[model samples]
Target: MRHRRPEDRRPPWGVRRTVFSGLVPLVVLFGWFTLAIRLGLPSAEPVGFLPFVFVAFAALVGFGRWLARAGILLALLGLLPVLAVLLGGWTATGDEILLSRGKPVVVLVSAESAHRLKAGLAYTYDVRNPDGSTDSLEPGVGTRLPVGSQVTVVEDPDRLVAPQLAGRQDPAVPLVFACLGTASLVAVVVSTAVAGERRRVRNATTR
Candidate 1:
C-alpha cells in the first residue's frame, strides 16, 4: 500500500487569510444571488444572470488552485439551489402576476416530443392554456407526459421564465438527485473528519 504524503496529512489553510481576498467576495455574491432565485423570490429574468456567475466560478477556481477541493465543493454546493429551482422544487411565490394556475386549470396536452442522445434527453410539449392560449412547455426532468394527456400549465404575465408543467413531473428524478446530493455531502463530511484526525495524530507524534 502507498503511504500518505506529508502534504496530504497537513491541515488546510484557514478561511481567514490575506491570500484569499479577491476570491471570497465573488463567491458570496454569486452564491447569494443563486440562493435568492432558488427561494422563490421574483426576478425579472433569473437565467440570464448565470453567465456572469459561471465566469466568476472559473476565475475563482483558477486563482485558488492551492485550495482546489474546497473551491470546487463550494461552487458545486452553490449550484444545488439553482438545480432545485429548475427541477420545479420552488417555482412560484404565490403572488407571481395573476397566478394563472392558482386554482390551476388543467387542459389536454396538444403535442409532445423528446430527443435522446448519449448525454441525455430533453422533453417538451404544447398544452391548451387556461384562458384558451397555447403554451409550449419544456418541463422539469421526469417521465414525459404523453400527447393527448391532461396536465396543468402555470404561466405568469411578467414572464420570468418558461411556462412550467403545473404538476406533471415524475417522482423519480427528484428522488435520484436527492440521493446523489446526500451521498456527496456524506462523503465530504467523512473525508474532512478523517483528515482532521490524521492531522491531530501527526502533531501528537511530533510532540
Candidate 2:
C-alpha cells in the first residue's frame, strides 16, 4: 500500500466522508426543525434553514470531509420549508402583520408619492412624528393622499416591520401570523431568477 497525503484522507466520495459530512448534518437539521417548532422559535423555518446553508456552504468550500457532509445535510434539509410553502395552499394576502397592536398617533404628511413596483405601486410618505420630528413613513398601500394631509399612523412597539396607516390596522393583528413561511420561498425564487438571468447573459456574450 502507498502512503497518501493528509488531504487524501477524504477521497471525495469515500464511506467516512459520506457519513461524517452527510449523515451528521441531516441529524442536526431534523433536530433544528423538531426543536424549533416544539420550543416556539421565531420564523422557525428560516431559523432552522440558515444554519444548514451555512454549514453546508462551509463544508463544500473545504472544511474537511465530515464537516462538508454535515453542511450538505443541512442544505438538503433546509428545503423542507420551501416545499411546504409552495405546495401548501398558501396565498399572499393584501395585508401583512404590522404589529401586535396599533398605536393611535397623528401624523402630518409633508410629502407622499406612489412609487411603482414590479407588480404595482407602493405609497411612500414623509410624515411629522408626534414629537415634532421628521421621519419617512410608507403606508404600503395604493391611494393618493396629498401633501399637508393629517392622517392616523399606527406604529408597533416592537418595530418588527414597517408601520402602517392607523386606518389600515386590522383587528386581528394581535392574533394572526399568516402568509406562512413565504419569505424564504420568495427569497429563493428571486435569487434563482437573478442567477439564471446572469448565467443567460454570460452564455449569450460567449457566443
Please tell me which predicted candidate would have the highest TM-score against the true structure: 1
Q: Show pairs that collide, candidate 2.
A: 21-69, 21-70, 22-69, 56-71
lDDT per residue, candidate 2, 3-99, as tens digits?
8989887555334433443444334444543443333222211234455445434533332223322324433433544334322211111123433
Predicted candidate 1 versus true structure: per-residue lDDT over 1-207, tens digit per residue: 999999877655532232244335445544644564454333322344466457645543443333333456545654553344333322333233324433455767888877663546767677786668776666644557878888766556555444655554344555455445435433433344344445545677999
Work out the TM-score per prediction.
0.42, 0.40
Off by over 4 Å in 2: 1-101, 157-161, 170-207
User: Least accurate stretch of 10 residues (summed lDDT) in model 2?
Assistant: 86-95
Ten contiguous residues with the weakest lDDT in model 1: 89-98
